[model samples]
Target: MHETKMKPTINITRLQSTFDVSSSIGTTEKGGLTRLALTKEDVKIRDVFVEWLEEAGLAVKIDDLGNIYGRREGKKKEAGAVMIGSHLDTLPKGGRFDGILGVLSSLEVIRTLNDLNIETDRPIEIVNFTNEEGERFTPPMQGSGVITGNYDKEIIYKLKDKDGISFEQSLIDSGYLGDIKNRSSNVDYFIETHIEQGPFLEENQKDIGIVQGVKGTKRHRVQIKGKSSHSAFPNSHRKEALLAASEIVLTIDEVAKQFEDLSTSIGVFDVTPSVESITTEFVEFTFDARHIDNAIKDQAIRLIKEKINEVSIKRKVEIDFEETWDANGTYFSKEIMKSIEEAVESNGYSHQYITAPALHDAKFMTDITKTAMIFCPSKDGLSHCEEEYTSIEDIEKVTNVLLRTVISLANQN
Candidate 1:
């Protein structure tokens, strides 16, 4: 067993102050935030992080992708570092503690270690990954995706927002376009602390959640084309794209219900020339599906495709399905997971092994290193909105667990 000379303590007051500082940058009317990646608000938060890190005497570095790293050197410089972090960007009007909590909690862990003057064999790093929300970008997890070789830097740089501004331009505008290499292949382990974003923990009365894995997600765009006609015309032989789209949506819901532990939804449904007098000529909708099992997820996709085809043929409308994004389910490292469990047990916190239904940067980090996550309860299971919240008491509990786990990993051989 790795021995500790002194037990570290997390400063809840300091943590709250840090949250106040970051949340102030993108305050919304509804008390949420809108700090999109690479935006001015995001840059302000990054600058604050750099200041805090430097004040703690940790060496700070920013990569080309604008990933901020605060490193605490160890006795063994050759040993791989234990990387811990989450993204800082939030969805539009997003809650203050979704991804931001993870990053700030990791900083708290580092701060606690510093206060104790604790040194481990392996270096410890707190990373603030850029664009984990991907609200502006098409796909999320861009920062970790780049580091894991899932995305090319050139392509990511060219990605444009709704405003037609390129990602490169935004980074440059924010003054965070660093020259440091974006890739880190030598990460010994990775851990992220985040809000549960669901009601499971709160409902179960657990203080901590040791996340076992993340569910896979598949996003697709479905377009239906049909002839336009006057609404007053006879409806018997008319091809209506909107009608076909409605049928497809119902079919998707039915198919999702057929499988256990599956989620499917059509978040966006658009009809062209949306006038009450004209029959719909074209319709487009986005399909999002997720499942913990790959086989189940694939089966659901197949069923949806078959249903769409059937609907198209019956409605006499041409349909096209375009796959927009896909990410397979990821399981965390067994060793790291065990360490977290141990930390929870040692800290006398009630915890349960859980799976993350929403996508996270830790899913991508698994590609390059052993990764795991710690989750605290969110009130009412609300996230990505202004109502999302987790009590400060819960935050403090999880932060302690995270600190213990980090200490354990840093001292490991």
Candidate 2:
């Protein structure tokens, strides 16, 4: 059994105040946030966060990837720091709670430590990873990915946004470009507290989700080429690419239901001559499949392809299915997970274990160090929209859990 005592609560009012102020930066008319990574609004928030960190007597550092780390020294300055945080960048029209709350709650942990005059054996650091939403950046989690050495920094620097602004140029302009040597790669533990972004916890009537892992994601582009004819053409004589595409779409959806805890979605769809009179001669769409188990995910991929091939042959059309991106499923440290569970128990919050369907910075952090996540409930299983919400009480519960967990880990030799 662990031998640490815990009794600290977060100042909910203060956290709410900070969250409200941040909600205004890059806020949309629909009450959502659009603070893409390294934008002016993002810069404003970073400045505010740094100011708060300095006031709390923490040393702040920014890396070449624009990832921010604020360190509160411990009695043992040489010990690896316990890092806790999430991304702050928001998707276009994204709800304010998704990434913003995790970051602020982490800062709250540090503030509470100061308020109580508590000192630990290990240092504590709060991080704010950049470009987690990939709204402006083509791929999300670039900061975490680059730091983990999963992506080359040169390629990441060369990526251009829709406006032709290179990522490297944007970072330089944001005034956050820092030496790569400062990448706080010496973390002993990394923890993140985020809204569930789905209805799992709320639907189950649980207060906290001790996240076990993140689902692996795979993306594929399916391009279908077929003969084009007028809409009035005989149904028997036509080879419509749209028809084959529709069959594949239905096949994916139908197969998803056959497997438990699997999700398949089509986000992009393009067609040639999409008019009333002309038949679709060309069609392309992107498919995303996510599951925690690689074996099951691969099985699903195989089944989906088999069905797609059946459609291609039956429809007498050519189909090209090519994978564009993939991230393997990642599991958190069992030891860190146990630590979170202990915090949940001490806080007397109802909880359950879950696997996140969406990728997070924590997923990539696991590549470098032991990492875990705490999840508060999202209303109606909705996210990436202005309507996403989690109660202040829920935030309080998780932040308190984070505080207690940090204390325990920091006290460890």
Candidate 1: minimum summed lDDT over ten consecutive residues — where?
1-10
Q: What is the lDDT of residue 380 in candidate 2?
A: 97
Q: For residues 147-248, what per-residue lDDT tens digits would candidate 1 score against the true structure?
A: 788999899999999999998898889888877564455689999999998899999999999999998999999999999999987888889999999998
Give me the overall lDDT of model 1. Answer: 0.89
Give Cα distance to truth, residue 182, candidate 2, Å: 1.0
Model 2, 1-413: lDDT tens digits are 22255477889999999899888888999899888899998999999888988998989899999999899998899998899988888988888999888899999989988888888889999889989888898788999889998889999999999999999999999999988988997789999999998888999999999999999999999999999998999988889999999999998998899889998999899998688899989999999999999888889999999998898888889999999999999999998889899899998899999999999999999889999999999989889999988889999999999998999998877
lDDT of 1 at 299: 91
Which has the greatest lDDT? 2
Once superposed on the true structure, which residue ranges of model 1 sit more than 4 Å away at CA?
A: 1-7
lDDT of 2: 0.90
CA lDDT of 347 in candidate 2?
84
